[model samples]
Target: MSTPYEVEHGVTAGQTGRRPQNRRVDMESFFSFLHQISTDAISSVSSETTPQTHNNRHAEATPVDTANLFRLLQDQFATLRQTSPDATNRDFLEALIQEVDRDIADLPRLHGVGQEFLDGLDRVSKKEILKGKKGEEKCPICAVKFNEDPHPLVVALPCHTSHCFDLECVAPWLQSKGTCPMCRKNFVRKKEEKKELKEDSEEEEEFDNMNGVWLATGYPQTVIAIRGVDEKGLALVRNGVEVL
Candidate 1:
């Protein structure tokens, strides 16, 4: 009678004296072949799905560095200007410049007084000041007496002198020129000073560029605003000085 192992292996006990060792070897070989096939199939699938270029993967995942991209585009424009002076090149360059100009125009202008600074200004009622016997003082902005002004709105500045102004008069002034009109004391320090203090723990004297050219480096992200960029390109004006 054939053993079960010999029967499974398709070798009868009567046929050439069934070898148990050979059956065991064949079973081991069969499993090994199956493992190899599985491994090869997995490898093929992975290879097919993988990106051809590592740079392409990185580009898709990472945000573009706009400052560098702008610089690169400018360099290309310069190169094109030097190499090709034909109408086609001229038209392309003009179109690119116009696009950049439009982008610059669209950016939000950095306000002289940020909302936090404006919010910190003390809002005092005109009636309260009159009750305190201090409403006789005149606002430096409009040269109008506080009690007599049509509007009741008033704001006290943080200067040591405690100079106050009518909210209507001072709001516009503060929006453009952040300063105490009475003392000419700066309400908001130059952005450069703030940046230097933040980075180096030291105050540095700010210098202006000769050609009215300034770069808005204080802003973290580069979006070319009207004040930040003119026909001369990317600049910031600080204290009546252009800073590049």
Candidate 2:
């Protein structure tokens, strides 16, 4: 019988669990551990789906195994919750566990934002967040006071000026829902709309480059709907006969 951590990662739990309780976890090491966990989960998913990838190599590879990745994240958070001495840390971890659990449950309906959108979100500085605020402002998702952390990474959503959130708390939600959790404003649709507009503009530019100059310079420029199209692909009638 293997422990959950051992089952998740082939390595024995003792090797990874050597961190002393009293030692402070550096930001880099903390995130690195999360990165490793997410990587292992993705590898596990890749192994399971190897046959599918082998069958259709042309298909785009999934970046992350959302279900497995969230599950692993939940497990880690739960473990941390168990061991955390501070009530605040425990509470935060518990909230994180629930968030991951909800993501796992809602896997079928989730259409999350890609890394590009997450990276492009407007960073809200502490000075900006504190400006003109008399009382403590809480993050909409975690409901934790913004000032609780000496330095909180806050982000502003495109939906509205007031729609701000703690980057740490809202990141997973955005990745899962691709919407403003407080206002339910859809970011995924906005991204798609922007993409469609860009493509349309590109196509229009290509068409204009190929035909616009020639038509403007060569023909009399009488634009009309015609059954016959000219060699230059223009629908122009010249002297009672459609130019072919």
Candidate 3:
């Protein structure tokens, strides 16, 4: 009888499974090339203008500006796609090219999750993801079956249970839009809103503390007055009256 394949929990693809050395090498090289392209693109952009200046220009950016940025990113990916021996890398580059086009579609309103949010995304193992009774699951971006890849590093968005995607496929999308591709849910913005609410609550509490204000139970009408004295041993007064 064939031995039952055993996979661990919360581990990446190549960490445990029968992943080939060539596939591992391909993965590493693909990501490294992508990183280089990103660095070059960002460096080129920085040479022309700072981030703040770029953002300001985006509001009034002409077609030429958009085209130049698009060309800069697209040309890099095209070159990578040409030199890459692996079909998977070419597929990823194709998807990324689409993302670049979409991003340039609306430069002024383009927003995405930052590196902090991306790093904080939850990674899940193949066993952790509950598959459907249907056919093989494929990545929405590259349309490649997850099972086909020997080392599929999948990430789960906080949006839903079934909202899982290949890390490589989803990273570019999240970095471009900060929303789930399947659900269109903006988890990053939701998180920021919750944080803002908590901050506002803290600010209100601090303001109350500074003013010596307290909520008294069953004494809504009770008046607890506060008076402040200056360094001169005199009441700090305002508008010709003693400040309470």
Clashes of each: 2, 0, 0
> Candidate 2 lDDT, tens digit per residue, 1-244?
2222233345443444422433212122222333343321111122232211133334331334456545544654555465675676677667666756766676534466654676688877767656636117666444555655444466789998788776655655565557786677889998889999999999897665553233333446654334433467666554456665
Q: Write the per-residue lDDT of candidate 1 for residues 89-117, one digit (tens) a residue.
A: 45555555454344344442222354356
Top-scoring candidate (lDDT): 2
lDDT of the structure predicted as candidate 3: 0.51
Candidate 1, residue 202: Cα displacement in angstroms equals: 13
TM-scores of the models, in the order given:
0.32, 0.50, 0.49
- Score each candidate by Cα lDDT: 0.43, 0.53, 0.51
Which ten-residue region of model 1 has the weakest summed lDDT? Answer: 38-47
Q: Candidate 1 or 2, higher lDDT?
A: 2
Candidate 3 residue pairs that clash: none
Best by TM-score: 2
For candidate 3, lDDT tens digit of each residue in 1-244?
A: 0110112133333344633333321223322232332321121111122321222222433454544445454654565566555677677778767767766765523255654676567766555434532116655544445666554566678898567666655655564456887677997689889999999999987654544343233665644432333466433333345643
User: What stretches of model 2 exceed 4 Å from their correct place?
Assistant: 1-64, 70-110, 211-244
Lowest lDDT 10-mer window, candidate 2? 38-47
